[model samples]
Target chain A: MSDDIRKKVFEIIAEQAVLEVSEIAPEHSPQDLGLDSLALVESIFAIEEAFGIEVPFNANAPQQGDFDISSIAAIAAAVERLVAEQRGA
Target chain B: MRRVVITGAGTINPLGHSVSETLAAMRAGRSAIGPLEIRDAGRLSVRIGAQVRDYVAEEHFSRQQLGLYDRFTQFALLAAAEALAQSGLPFPDGRTERAGVVLGTAGGGVGTWDESYRAVYEEGRNRVHPFVVPRLMNNAAAGHVSMRWNLKGPSFSVATACASSNHAMGLAAQMIRAGQAEVMLAGGSEAMLCFGGIKAWEGLRVMSRQACRPFSADRDGMVQGEGAAVFVFEEYEHARTRGAEILAEVAGFAMTSDAADIVMPSREGAARALAGALADAGLAPEQIGYINAHGTGTAANDRTECAAVADVFGAHAGRLMISSTKSMHGHLIGGTGAVELLACIMALREGVIAPTVGYRAPDPECPLDVVPNTAREARVEAVLSNAFAFGGFNAVLALRRA
Candidate 1:
């Protein structure tokens, strides 16, 4: 189930970043993947739509947000946790 | 070229129902933003707004007029009436062919659209109101104002998203200055607190559930507000001949488009408008004593506005006092600039500068003196009011003390 969520996240990010799924590595930063503000927002929206969940975005402090984007892996990990919490709820 | 001056002003906003009341609220450091009292509040992620509370439409308008008039139009007519009464215009003699109106409204009858859409889509109804088209048209308020005042010259509405009112007022002043009109009633009104309107803005993700603290480091985002403000911008000689009390001299105005991003603001574009207005007025940067900043509380806007001010004003930037009344009134979007002009008049005419009430922490990016949390008695010789819209429209107006 965790791998499925990670794969979905990577696919969504690849589509938003205008890159192939294979080009997206777990360690790459969003900037390294060439994602601008609009692209990043679109990726978040796609993830929310796919998981049927809401993501909390903060101003001036991305680390404090519910979804961490230090790297692609961090985002996947956060999404996995949020999806798990949603299922439990 | 003739000089343009403001002779009359009226408003019905979150701060107050009249200019005196609104100025009084600003003097006491009052913020009217609170929990938004509207339908479907439970479904909305953000519910706090600066709404005009305790207003009953029936008390102000007849039932027949309400049928044709949207909430935005109603607010405009009320404000226009007050302003005309103050200006003593359309005098006992008669209306002039050189008189007209130019009002701004982003969503003219947004409330009517929201209600009709709900009736047809959500409630599964087919037929809607027959007057929906006229009510929802963007120029409805402007048309009604012109007809009511018997203004026969150039009259129209401007819709540049957030900078609508500033553009309208600037154009009106330009018309008067060019000798095309002698008297033009200008300003803006907005009543977009309906569910559809809020929901549409929510998609932009630039709203804050908390307070709007512009120029503050920890500020999150902008809070929405609603209402209208109208002013009579007349030729200086015309106003003087008619024995009208001049509120402030509309010294100079300039507008520019970024032509860049759809949502993001450009610093160079904003700086151009500021500098252009000063050059138009032939006033040096040192002459501007106060500025009502387009401080929308968003991180990008505050930083960019400060940078623009710094770019245009140079060393004088540090000396000038700047504040965002949005902290108290919320972001009215289209109607914001017109309502904010009142702050400029108050600062120039009354020597009272309204404070940015929600400011807590200082932002290094915005190092200018932001009159924070309390009103100050400072005699300002000249002032500038700024409005930078989402679509990269920048409008700046310079006003001198009357």
Candidate 2:
């Protein structure tokens, strides 16, 4: 995982959650970070748009999907993998 | 207070273009959801919608009419014509003064708005069509239905998102009950299957790409549908004097607001509306045999609605036959409740319960009998229709067998 990717994802999530970047921690879950459904969805969209890769996630089946949204660090790692795969393809 | 009864019903929906056609499709448990045929379908992640197929505007309207009628208005007009014909009401006559039109739509002329925006932003057009305002107005459908039939009493449109139709019909029934009007053409219509409509919903990320499977454990989200359903809601005595065919009685109606989160549903608010409707109809929980659920196939809605039904009906909720016709026709958004009302009518009049098609697995959270995947024959004296909108607006209508 790249720090650049993690930092960018944190920035997007922080913006949607209306919190400072420094206030967020990689171990914090979306719920723990206090992201509502709308905010969570916006964070995903912003992350996708920033990374130029589709994040395969459904709000209803968030737990079933391959994208690990269990924590902020997990989401960033998934985004790193998606970016690498999309660029390689 | 006057009694309200449905003397006629008409619909041009994904299931069919007529009442008989719709009932037959519902009986057969057919699904109309399919691939999108609109412009920029490839651009959308969610490409499926329950669209009114084989629709040709030129066959139904003239060139001048097409210029003024958006897709939503066209569906409303067609359904209204069929309903009025079935009702056998000669408009612009002596009785016309006591008749009115009240219809509903979530996004009025969404396609027109999309086209106009594209013309200005994408194509760089300096100006749009002169009739664009009239074509896309929210009241365009109701206004046209009123003018076309010369309904002079009261005519307007309601836009409470998904609950628009139920609210419109409920208000129409209230008007007749209060002696404000003897007859009303009440229902709803929506044509938001275009590029703009789906694109906007796509942003919300609440749409499913494949199907709308309400109550199914694997259900992802709702699929959008398009069409209109209109009915002739006439005073009982007025209908009887004319020897009109009575479909069902609009026995009770109740509405409530959650005042909670705009998107998330409140179980207490939904339960209050359900209990209120049953109480208004002077019927106990056990008297109600069927409920056309506001099951949008979303996890949040199905779970909350089931919880509400369970809370309202108690042990009787398990005995009640509740189904979501949206599984077959998809969520029509504003016009959905009107189309779902037809299912309630079928339950009361024909002893047929429409199935919630596309059910694969059951979710434990939704423990009630969902009448999954297959239509059933059941005799019921009364049934209820539920519509809860995005803004936490809840409206439920109860109907009695005629």
Candidate 3:
């Protein structure tokens, strides 16, 4: 389930960046992958929709949002944790 | 003081898509108000609107441009292009830095907001477009125009409800008079004929479901319209030096606040604006030949406007021609004043008076010579365009033959 979530997250991020999923490495920064602030927010929205979980996002202070967006792996990990929490709740 | 003159004009309203087409339609006294073709029209109580029919975004803009340009921005760009082309005043070398853009719009990108909000709230969709913020900003149209024209001077947008375009044009002329800019692209645009735009106005109960018949006895209310009009306002000397064909002189402008009611029209405030405009133009009330009234087809607006005209112009009001083109083009809200300025230009330059169509029964209160149902040919030296917004904001502009 965790692998499936990570793969889906990478696909969504790649789509936003207008790149192939194979080109987006897990360790690469979303910004390095051409996801600007606007595209980053869109990726977060897509993640929230795919997982049916809320991802905190502040347009003014994006880095301080509850969701970690430092890199593709970090975002996937955060989404996985939120999904687990929602299931447990 | 520097004098400002209109060198070029363009418009894309319900009546037509260019200045020539719109003026021809006005000359024919044609009505553009008809059934609304917007999405979800069956759900709206107001089913009629003056929409700019046959406008396709894909035909004018590329995919990348369309992603950033909202409907209002597109309208402004189209109108601006025509105005600039007609002016033939090439911003040569350093002159580009001295030109600016000032546009008015009440709902800058409400259509974009409406679609995104509906997607997230009603359709249960989480992901929306990435450029939504840039697309929905109130200054988006101004910013795009500035970037396109390389206008590095003062560029901004004004939002004063229905009087926005008048305020914008007035301010742009002031900038030229104050030596801030040599040339300014001034006008306004609106695209609030969407589902959400009409739905919100439904609460106000001021919309007409049938047609807009301003200053008529059987008039119900104002109908909404969408489009844009743009003009090139240049220093009179600069235009003369370049051999540009001057359309009309923007002689004077005055704005007065009612400070009385939020929605109801005030006779005192309207009269003050009319008087102030005449004073600013250094002309007597009797010198004016025509007046494009701010007749919204509402009972309150028509009566109060007539009383104010009587108070200010007195006996001269009976002699001058007073008409409301809103009866034909409907009301463009923030963009209405800019479009109505076309009628004033026609009256001043071409000796043509656009009529107030859809006149059914005569209202004794509005007893002015409203050129009803047919266009009349008359030589008018000067005209005034009146725009009174909701919130008691009044702005009147004076124009004279060039």
TM-scores of the candidates, chain A only:
0.91, 0.93, 0.93
lDDT of 3 at B93: 42
Clashes of 1: 0
Per-prediction TM-score of chain B?
Answer: 0.99, 0.99, 0.99
Candidate numbers, best DockQ first, in rank order: 2, 1, 3
Model 1 DockQ (Cα-based): 0.45
Please identify which of the two predictions, 2 or 3, would achieve the higher lDDT against the true structure. 2
Best by lDDT: 2
- Clash count for candidate 2 is 0
Say which docking band candidate 2 falls in.
medium
Residue B118 CA displacement from its true place in model 2, Å: 1.1
lDDT of 2 by residue, B33-79 (tens): 99999898999888999999998889999999999899999999999
Which sections of candidate 1 miss by over 4 Å?
Answer: A59-61, B91-93
Model 3 chain B is weakest, by summed lDDT over 10 consecutive residues, at B201-210
Residue A31 displacement in candidate 3 (angstroms):
63
DockQ of each: 0.45, 0.67, 0.01
The first chain of model 1 has a TM-score of 0.91
lDDT per residue as tens, model 1, A1-89: 89999999999999988899999899999989998666777788798899998777654345556778889999999999999888773
lDDT of 1 at B375: 95
